[model samples]
Target chain A: MSTGDFIFTGLGHAYLKDNWIFRNYRGEAVRGQVLALLGPNGSGKTTLLKILLGALTPSEGSVNIQGQVAFVPQLFQVAFDYTALDMVLMGRAKKVGLFSQPTPADEEAAINALERMGIGHMAYRPFHEMSGGQRQLVIFARALVAEADILILDEPTSALDLKNQNGILEWIDRLARRENLTVIFSTHHPHHAYAVADQALLMLGENDFESGPVGDVLTEKNLLQLYGLPLKRLTFDYEDLNVETLVPVFRNCKRRKAN
Target chain B: MTEKTVKQEKFSACSSGRFRRWLPKTPLARPWILGLILLIAIIGSLFMGAYPIPWHRILEILLNSVWPFSGSESAYLDLREITVVTLIRPPRILVAVLAGIALGMSGTALQGMMRNPLVGPDLVGVTSGAAFGAVLAMWLGFLYTPVILVLSTIGGIAAMLGTMALARVVGGRNDSLPLILAGFFIGAFFLAGVGLLIYLENPFYPKGQRTGNIIYWLLGTFRGAGPVKAWTIAVPTIVGGTVLMGLRWRLNLLSLGDLDASSLGINLNRLRWILITVVSLMVAGQVAVSGVVGWVGLIIPHAARMLVGPDHRRLIPASAMLGGLFVLGLDNFTRTVIWSEVPVGVLSAIFGTPLICFLFWKTKTKGWNE
Candidate 1:
């Protein structure tokens, strides 16, 4: 079963006839790989993500998915005041019987998932009361307990602060590299893609897309074309370590240091 | 983490996973302990009516009615007190308890399914439809039979179907607002029909002749509770409550909205309809047996959430017990404390609307403390 973990080609969707959101999109994800999707707002990144998650079907193409796929939606609020443990335990929905309550074994597994996320101490705490980072990690713990082979995250770290963003990126890397789970996340950050992604897909237009290794695909020229904003590959040394980061060089910034 | 200490945890321990939340967290409010308290409250209520009866005489009356025993306590039992406790109080208390349980359970299931805190069974128009059906049956001269109850159940289901179909015509299946608005209109329509039927039944007569019976029933009092009425409400509540309680965990997921729940490999359509049908059936039973006991279906679930913290496994049972207590307390207030009988449904609306206002103010100002 090694003909690429999954592949989709010529995928396109439109809410109305001839009003295509994105088209001619194709990508392949393998096990132990993190694929990042980059696009501007209204570029149908969410639509493409929905297609990959099998929640929505592409009008023109097909996604051949393999293994159990677990989806971690973007930061959200629950209507009820469910506890953190209760939130994680809902991951067992696929495992628990229709008429049966969750047994001690299931409860133990949920607790372990929370513990693995390092938020076990907040098990009994209300979910809505938790911070955005805590909630995102709780969703990650839910995905882990579901025993998913593929993880689809929709802008997982877009709403978090810088620290939580990096924390989420680290977990995404770890889940793919160590857990051997294929991850595909959609975000607006090109640097996030450069930092963690093996391959990047940029949806430029309805029929235009760029896909390749992160190095070749996330070039300054290509990102500038994709976002209509120039992004430079800046190199700097931090703590005696050679590092590179992408920064958008906005044209509106004041050129002179002092007036 | 917020200092919301659950007063319902000891009772919450009767459950499994979250039930254990009570054992290590809070050390009181066990199920049997609460059950004992409920029993005492119920027995204490029996002695509360205008015609007072002592506890021992009440027990003797119950025993002599059920048990063929040679006891000297029968000598002390008076006919009037025995009639008050056995014939009158038992059925009234039974109806109140069963209706409360039904309303509470239905409210929890509904709130979980709708994923909105403001949702209630009465909001969906099923109660008014059932009320119309009962009134229609009474108008057709089947006032003292089970026909009204049967028609009431059918009417509730029919009204819900109409609400759905109307919503489908307008908003399709995905939007939640159409369904709610459709329920509001359909419920109002049926309530108007109920009013028309009542007026048509006795146009020239004054209020008290035949209209008094219809008007009293419409106000929803337990003044005429009997074995027949109590059993009618009990059958659907027990059956539907069992099905709903079993689905508590699934409801926690279903309430996560359509997208994530579908990702979880659950069939949302089948689950949603099952919940609707069962909730409609239980509400229909309450409305049929005791005319539209208004706010228990709206109020009890929120109160239970404050106590049990929104885990449906604990919330369902806790709301149910609280429901019975709330309605029973209201009935006691009207029957004993007041010189004249006030309707339970009316009393519940008076209490429920204020609670809603308080909740709105609290949630609005605090923002769920996010």
Candidate 2:
């Protein structure tokens, strides 16, 4: 197998002396591949994402990526009420000269990106006013305008509703497949990862990680170990298509059949 | 590589994109229209003040000065009228306009860099530091215009460095709270330093004719406006403001906060410091020329933002023009309409405080977002 455009070997980080958040993390994501990061709260998932985006340096190890990188943070409110077009146009930040503004062609590219995302109608609408799912799409359009071959997202669907979550998930798959983009994302929902990810990195604890193909890494055992809750990886038929998903055993629910 | 990619991505009828004009929707919001208004105001302001020079005569004086042929035919014009029109009023007017532009542009840049509308040169400790430098220059008996200007710029940069250091110590870029506190701390410290210098100077030079200069610099006014003073402020504002305008578009990206902007391939520290240095130069020059003119720097940008919205490409030029106009108008009001020789600084604070209060009250209606 060929080594991918993105590779991080023996990655580690610590905010304080002798207090590593995580260490000895090694991973690589190739073209058109989707990698999902699964970890409990404070398991250095966001920190790892930052390291890949080059926003922060790991305490020990280095990351090397061959192509452009675009980071889609959580659906956030900007300080100013910039239009969706304005937000997307800023993706040309690299092409824009130090002493020059974005030209008309650059603006056209931004508009085309919005249209490609199927949100061309609301290009002039304020970004802060957009729905959560739409905002994620807008950011995806931004990554496209940036010509990013690597997309790093942190909890892209966290603040979104269930329908919006599906919308985001579909786009994530479509962008990876159609554009041949390397996509790395973190999520609380393992089913979302199981449905989409080719490779899974289960960050169970500091220096303790299980990573490989989804078939190997995303097991009921890893799910239980990762969340400290009884989880079932169930397979069933739904509307003539075979389906596989993870469901956790609840604390109060009487339905213990999955467990 | 970029050129290759550009051609490969086939364009699909994106003819309706809003790049026709970058100005705000309203006619009054246009920077050029406001610039024209400022020109008319500048010409109109020449007719104001204690020595009333008529419009036609002032026009003749101005035209003759520039177009030598007009003055020869217009020898009927009084020499005193020519002097007042061409010499005295123009210098003061230029000084006021330049200072205003400096304040406005500086405020807008500061706000954009900090990603908070509340930030200005004064709030960031630049104005006070520059003021202290100018006062110190006077205390040391160095009245050289360039020396005062240079020292003031150095002082402003020093103060900005202090503010940044303090901000980092407390909290980093994601929060604007620490920046505000640091600015306030450094500004107050510099103001005290200026006060001590003045107190120390008076004992040695009791009959030194320095009190008037002290009051002028501290309170801010056109009392000392002259050709030299105008140049002291003009050079920096024109040069620095141009650089600021040229780089204004980057502010939109920078406003996305530290982590986000950095991820976008911006060298956050380098870009931020460059912008900060330019802002310090302009603000310091204003203080060197006209003293620490208070509320114009702190508040005029808000009025500009109201007219132009938050896009820095439009906002920077709009603020600069709007600032110059505001300063010229304020100076005219105090110089002609008001009975007292009220310092423009005092008047600006008087006018500016209410506007800030109004802005504060407006936040409730606008909903907290920043």
* Every candidate's chain B TM-score: 0.85, 0.90
lDDT of 1 by residue, A13-122 (tens): 99899899988888987887889999999999888988888888788987897887888888577878777888888888889988788888888998999998888877
* TM-score of chain A, all candidates: 0.95, 0.96
Model 2 lDDT per residue over B1-370, tens place: 5532442352222233555433345676778888898899888888888777777887888888888786665868989998888789888999999898999998988888888777789888999998888888888877877789988999999999999889989998557799999999999999999988876775667674796678666898887588898888889999999999888999999888877787777778888889878998998888888887887876877787778767888889989899999999889999899887788888888888998888778665764363
Interface quality of candidate 2 as DockQ: 0.43
CAPRI quality band, candidate 1: acceptable
- Supply DockQ values for each candidate: 0.48, 0.43
Model 2, retained fraction of real contacts? 0.60
Question: How many residue pairs of model 2 clash at the backbone?
Answer: 0
After aligning candidate 1 to the native by TM-score, how far in Å is the CA of A164 from where it should be? Answer: 1.2
**Distance from true location, Cα of A60 in model 2, Å:** 0.5
lDDT of 1 by residue, B1-370 (tens): 3333452442333455543564333321233444465677787787778776666777777778778485566877788887888789888888888888888888888888877676677777878888888888877777663677778877887887788689789975445688789889999999999988877775445555777788888888888888888888888889898998899888899888777888777888889888878888888788877887887887888777765567788778778888888888888888888888888889889888898777767668545335
Q: Each model's C-alpha lDDT?
A: 0.81, 0.85
